[model samples]
Target: MTTDAADKPRAMEEEAPPGMRRVPGGAFQMGSDAHYPEERPAHRVVVDGFWMDATTVTNDQFAAFVAATGYATVAERPLDPAQYPGAQPELLVPGALVFHMTDGPVDTRDISRWWRWTPGAQWRHPHGPGSDLTGLGDHPVVHVAFEDAEAYARWAGKELPTEAEWEFAARGGLDGAEFVWGEELAPGGVHLANTWQGPFPWRNFEADGFTGTAPVASYPANGYGLHDMAGNVWQWTTDWFAARHAADPAKPCCAPQNPRGPAMEESFDPRQPQVRIPRRVVKGGSFLCAPSYCRRYRPAARHAQMVDTGMSHIGFRCIRRDPQNVQGKQKP
Candidate 1:
């Protein structure tokens, strides 16, 4: 809830930095009409005009922040035994883990085989201590948790967009368009974003012109002048995660105005039983997105994750509401 006077209005026509866009806000369908259950109950959400990042935060931007503030990511922090009871003593290493893809069909029951816990995998050394951002400075910084994103936002005098604002901006003014560009993911047989071009976790044809993370703004922009909203990486939002429409009998199905998600609960997790879990909603699919597998590229799509967990695909963008527009203010 930090605010700064330095974040005042500037020239609207001024050119935005790389991986950012100006989202002229209006009314749009926030949730999905026929996608994941959580995105159901197609709700109308009105957002005041604001500027948003055209793409997720990149490695270069994150590196600058770290250098200026000397900020350490959550993964680099020591695990507290009191918080995570029964955690193995060996697991309390001081480095972040990296997930490396292996050849073959991994066991569906144990997906952890593909995701190895590598120590010293921070933002600078994404793959491990030996790996560095190097030539991939323009690529989105991954392995960032919600708190990490928030810290970066605060340092930059920005904040994460609410779920309502995120969906409205992500739609790019198409109003219920299936994908960011159009109905077809590969229009005219051309890949638009950095997504898997082959079998899931097995092989990537690199048809989209990238096997892994692509340079930001390497693809076409959406109708609203946003880039890589469909793929590349999953962006974090400020809303707390809630169940799908089918599970919430008391939830409203119609379009909501400046809607924030349900109040934070004591506990929340997608894999756990349908109990109250306090997780945040993550929007936009990642490079791993696919029709045969994770099809969350749609604008109305959503996924949930624990606020503390950081993965290679999860990153974030920043937003700020127009000072004159109070209607879009988030509820306290």
Candidate 2:
């Protein structure tokens, strides 16, 4: 936990990233007790105002960054067998996780039934080898690993938001609201965010008018005038993933100020001790979330993602926490 002078409110004068909105930060409830166990003991947190992109980074934006740097995303590079000692050699290829719709209802408990590691499934080739970003330039760039997003942020002179900052901005000043818009998931039978409308893994009602990623801002903005804060894609946060949130400060006066998550060693996946990759906290569910299975299209919802893996449903946005949005000057 870190704290600056909470009384001394500093106005960070800076040029925000293009298409970003400045979030005037204050105290808010950071987690949820209603949903998953990991989001328990909703705690109090305070953050300083920062500029956040109105939406996730679009494919066009990522393309521009790659063009300028000739950077290859993690999915495009061959996997090192050394990382997974006993893994099958056939599975050790350049690829990414892509969600394949099942023909009928299947056991949702095993996610491997639908999520397949398809070769050549990078950001550009979202679906597979033949797929390309021919018409989806404005859609959120998916299949981006943690390092890929960091590289893009560095190239753009920005930084990824902390879990606290991202949640604060997502809440949009509605201190304890269930959804980004309000308590109801969809008011007046309208689709508020890009989430699954039907059963999980097998069927998609497409009631939201999108089976996959929708273009940025296709949905309405939150109270802070930031779009897609609830869904469309899960955005990366800088904090390491914790099994559960820390209890709120015992004293009201000492509530965590600009708090971050646990250390890297603490974030390693317990289920796979042999694999040393750490997981970070990813906020705001994705298009794959559903009512029956994963109803995580809310401000308080969060998921842990392994730092080394890139999936088709994951994307990211950048933030500016310093007065000047210069390199190495911004805070997480």
TM-score winner: 2
* Model 2 error, position 332 (Å): 11
C-alpha lDDT values of all predictions? 0.75, 0.86
Give the clashing residue pairs of candidate 1, or none: 20-54, 43-255, 44-255, 95-120, 267-276, 267-277, 267-278, 268-277, 268-278
Q: Which ten residues in a row have the lowest lDDT in candidate 1?
A: 1-10
What is the TM-score of candidate 1?
Answer: 0.87
| Clash total of candidate 1 | 9
Instruction: Provide TM-scores for the models.
Output: 0.87, 0.93
Which lDDT value does model 1 have at 172? 77
lDDT of 2 by residue, 1-332 (tens): 23334322453445545788878757888899988888888988878778889989999999999999999999999888888888888779999999999999999878899999898899999999999999999999999999999999999988898888999899887889999998899899999899998888888989999999999999899987899998799999988888889997779888777788888878865546665778999999999999899988888888889987889899999987765423223233
Candidate 1 to native Cα RMSD, angstroms: 5.0
